[model samples]
Target: MGDYLKKACCLLFALTTLAAASPVFAADVLHIQPKQHDCGLVDEGVPATMTAVVENVSGRDVHVSSVKTN
Candidate 1:
């Protein structure tokens, strides 16, 4: 019983310390430079291309599974 109480106290102390010392992180946001697209006389069946610069300024690398444009 004494050992269990000691272990529980230690665990609680460790968790509290971690919660207080750790830094909080915010959600990442996507920034699109051109926010607009203009297809000037392009064929409907032809493929159009655009340059994109995607970055994560949220102090972490974001994993992207898929992207779709409509």
Candidate 2:
């Protein structure tokens, strides 16, 4: 069906544009050391602190607004 094909093309284009506009697509511009870390044998209710190195290799100025921990 011609109408169905036209709709499918439009949907694909919209999805592609959405992906390109997302910040997740630009994540590769930064290099983060120690992508994963292990804090071993931590007691409950105690705080643990770790440091991560972030480098910008994208040849463009990048501002890091925040950092999150899990």
- Which model scores highest in TM-score? 2
Clashing pairs in 2: none
Per-model C-alpha lDDT, please?
A: 0.64, 0.74
Per-residue C-alpha lDDT of model 1 across residues 1-70, encoded as one tens digit per residue: 9999999999999999888766342122443344455555667798876545555545545676776888
Pairs in clash, predicted candidate 1: none
lDDT of 2 by residue, 15-70 (tens): 99898888676676665445556556677798876665555556777788888867
Candidate 2 at 68: error in angstroms? Answer: 1.9
Residue 57 miss distance in model 2 (angstroms): 0.9
**TM-scores of the candidates in the order shown:** 0.34, 0.41
